[model samples]
Target: MRHSIAIVSLVLFVLSMALLLTLAKQAYIPRKEVRDLAKIYLNTTYNPWNKKFTAMSPEGVTAIVWDYRGLDTVFETAVFYLAIIGSIALARGIGKYSKPTSDEKKLGLSLIVKTVTRITTVSIIAVAVSIALHGHLTPGGGFQGGATAAVAPLLILIAFSQYFLLERGVSKDLMLVIRSLGLAGIGLTAIAAYFIGVAMNKYAFVLQNQAKPLSEVSIPAYIDGQLISGTLWFFNISEFFAVMAGFTIVLILLVIPERAFKSSGGEEK
Candidate 1:
């Protein structure tokens, strides 16, 4: 009976998908002209005439993310924070793990692996920072850069051990603080315009940049003749730190032993 039910369900699902595809094809309408909104964004994205509204980023995607749809990005960052918080909650007892002995701390890969990791880690972090900082000019942004930076810590964790990091003062608590500071920076950047407007009796909105009128808080697009995407740079930098710290915390928690929970008299769900 179970097998018969499974077969029937599979057949129904397939039939539904087929019907949906056929209906979609039947209802399809071809368009020769570009969408009005798409054309407008394309035309104005990099145009000097639209400097007030245009993010100087040559990359349209970065402009849209950091300028046109900033609130969406802010919410996305918040969602990432919530996910990290959930992970921390789920692994509440892991932090109670006793410190490993000096010998146990050395129980990692050989000298060759450690040497290679040390050599590459700095380069990886540098590239990630470059990606993040150049996000407005290029394709990548804070989230991407932060994820890239995270590879360094992960490499260290694998090449060495958690105890090695702990001895060096890289703890979950420190990461949490870093993450919090990053998030705070993001918030401050987002509302800086609003606060400035209030202080100066001008009109402003949250996340307003050079794109909007009465936006007294302006980040310079060129600092000493060097191109910088202003608020976009700030956002990317904050996001890089937040994401890097959050991921590091999560990785550390994952590597913690299950025995730690039991030893600490903490219940497992």
Candidate 2:
């Protein structure tokens, strides 16, 4: 009798949940459409002649990504870099010189693994660069590109053992420099924006009109004489470097064996 009661109760509970979900979806789907359409109308048509930006601008999303909400993205990028750095630092402290089986038995890896890694590294590097450069025009931006680029070195370490990668060349310090330089470039771009006197929304860098701003930095865009604010691209470069450095640091620290750092006394070296 108790088992039967429990089963009946379970069935009722599931039925109730399903009914509630159905009712909520029926209400929400239309409401969501209405709200989204309202928002689109407000942003696009609210200010029709936003200094040559029409409702038909193809770079509309790009403008919003950098100009409308760039501060948030900048902070988010900073947090991501910080988290990656913190994780790598923590891992490095715990395993400065541990030995891995791969390190000890480098001969065991197949030729296919070696060949694939080589090919993957080059391809990933190219893709990363492409993504970073075309970020303004396409879907992938600095962060995505940088993360992709970070994978190439990681692939090398995985395919050729940490010892081989570390000893033969490609030091962590060198990668760090490359990553830091990218971050620095981003910082400088922000500084440039602040100094250029048009960091806000009132004045745009370009438009359908041929009128150029009085500012010194104007790189031509695809829309005829349309150009992009150089500061936006600068920040993108910064983001790219920060991500690349953070990821590279994490990969190097994690892949190498803790035994590699051990002293003669068997303590971590």
How accurate locally is residue 57 in candidate 2, as Cα lDDT from 0 to 100?
A: 24
lDDT at residue 165 of model 1 (Cα atoms): 86
Candidate 2 — which pairs collide? 97-258, 97-259, 97-260, 97-261, 98-257, 98-258, 98-259, 99-259, 261-269, 262-269
- In angstroms, how far off is 178's CA in candidate 2? 1.8
Leading candidate by lDDT: 1
Q: lDDT tens digits, residues 1-269, model 2?
A: 76998999999999998899898875344543456744664465224355333232234454455545556766776788688778766654442454454446554367888887788888888888878766655666777788898888777777777766777767778777877787777666545533443654333333212123354333323345443333444555667777887787888877655454453234533
* Candidate 2 residue spans exceeding 4 A from truth: 1-20, 24-27, 30-49, 52-62, 92-108, 198-229, 261-269
**Native-to-model Cα distance after best TM-score fit, residue 176 in candidate 2, in Å:** 2.0
TM-score of 2: 0.68
Instruction: Assess the local accuracy of residue 259 in candidate 2 as a C-alpha lDDT between 0 and 100.
Output: 54
